[model samples]
Target: MTDSSKWFESLRVSYEQGELNESDITHNPFEQFNLWLQDAINNDVPEPNAMVLSTVNKQGQPSARNVLLKSADENGFIFFSNKTSDKATDLKHNPHCSLLFSWLPQHRQVIVKGKAEEISMQDSNSYFQTRPYGSRISAWVSDQSKVIKNREELEVKVKEFMDKYPENVPMPSHWGGYLVKPESIEFWQGRPSRLHDRIRFTKKANNWTIERISP
Candidate 1:
């Protein structure tokens, strides 16, 4: 095989897009996050709401995957998935999790440390009804994260679910949303000479404390 180490070392980019200063950021982490998210959207970054969710299982083994951020506010962030999925299982065992938003095109990233809890079924159903018909059907068909024979098996089940719910598809009991209440949020901005800017906001008793950390 080709020398992959050389290929990896040969790739490099100088980050000079912007600089983040404490004076430039909002006092509230949630507002700051929204500002960066809006910047990503304005820059035409694909899937701007996509975030990496990291969770640790009961065994302390960590796992991470990208999931779309369905909503965010002062309450925290929200995302949905199959209740029986591996990530869900991880959350069930360990509520503490982390979320990462990487906007590489803009040379910025946001990290959130939080505790995730299941949202009310009523809220989940409301969002579920808004999904496309095919998506709703797929939710019922796939046992997400479960082993199956092959693509044919999944496709067969898909067809069956489609036939069963040709009209209004009801949300599956196994599928729902989780709300993550953040305890801390950090924003990182890439800079020249690898001297990145790091700003972190820690939540205290009904207030937030901001600090600038060394790169």
Candidate 2:
């Protein structure tokens, strides 16, 4: 096993602090999610909003990657990336997706399952313009997920972009955001004896149906 695998295998902490219950949760899943996210922020979990975004290709193969959570509202979670990338291409064929957020230190985890949709161009433009100069330039340089010849070639193109744009870097045509409209969300809280607690909220008609699940 790798170092990381051995590290997990040697974990000794017995989670005994929290438990998920209906009364402890917000009526609205989105609001509850935001609250948990805020806690993650407050506790300074590494990359608090960073989540694993999973998508399925046309051939039914699953792929995933770490992506920053840019925004979240009543509609759902949002993250931005290259529209021409593998994840985006997979999204085009299979719009369904999953976003997993793990707060290991807090013994808490959240999973969101949803359908992906493109945000408005106006929204994309706004977010793009706010990014740093280097990031904006990298967005222009990287084709994302595409095969590259070598590291030198990639850096060469990046350097060219840097030289070309001595001032501000304009947003690339292929970069934008995708919103995940969640149909269901599950929140887990670790407890003693490995008897964890899980609360699930599922979208049914216009309202959400909340239910407790065995953990």
Candidate 3:
């Protein structure tokens, strides 16, 4: 095998940054998530809102991509994207999904297994209006996941949209937000000697039950 392959097989990192205890976590997973998220932000973790979203298609093939967490509440975690995108298509075929937030710098991670559903048009419009003008234009430029001939094609579309909506770029019909209503959320903290900490909260019948999970 090549040296690069050997290095990849031998790479290892010790988990000794932190620990999680039952007393340190809130019973409400949302509250606990907020605490960890804020800590990540305060510690200068890059793009702290970025999360890995995993979705499975009708054929049972799973895919994962990084998306920004735009909002979170008692209801669910929200993110926006083109409805026609591959991920969106997978969601339409199968709403069940997973989200993972990795704060390696803080030796923390959060995983959410959930169902996804689109937000209301009004809410999508509200968020779209807050986006940068260039972002709005870019959203209109590409039909995400669709094959294009060249970069010039996207550039042309961007230019066209930029000229069409010079002032306020309206939210495209194909663009909107989805809320991931978590059925279970797990928090993980790295501990010494690979004895990690895991706490999980599961929702059932409008109530949440917290549990300690073996790491």
TM-score of each model, paired residue for residue: 0.97, 0.94, 0.96
The order by descending lDDT is: 1, 3, 2
What lDDT tens digits, residue by residue, belong to model 3 across residues 79-126? 999999999999999999999999999889999999999999999999
The TM-score ranking, best first, is 1, 3, 2
User: Which ten-residue region of model 3 has the weakest summed lDDT?
Assistant: 1-10
Candidate 1 Cα lDDT to native? 0.95
Best-fitting candidate, measured by TM-score?
Answer: 1
lDDT of 1 by residue, 162-215 (tens): 888889899999999999999999999999999999999999998999999999
Error of 1 at 106 (Å): 0.9
TM-score of 1: 0.97
Q: List the residue pairs that clash in candidate 1.
A: none
lDDT tens string, model 2, 1-215? Answer: 47897798788678986777888899999899999999889998999999999999999999999999999889789899999999999999999999999998789999999999999878998999999888988898899999999999889988999999988877788999999999999999998878899999999997999999998
Regions of model 3 farther than 4 Å from truth: 1-11
User: Any runs in candidate 1 off by more than 4 Å, and if so which?
Assistant: none
Report the alpha-carbon TM-score of model 2 versus the true structure.
0.94
What lDDT does each candidate get?
Answer: 0.95, 0.92, 0.94
**By TM-score, is 1 or 3 better?**
1
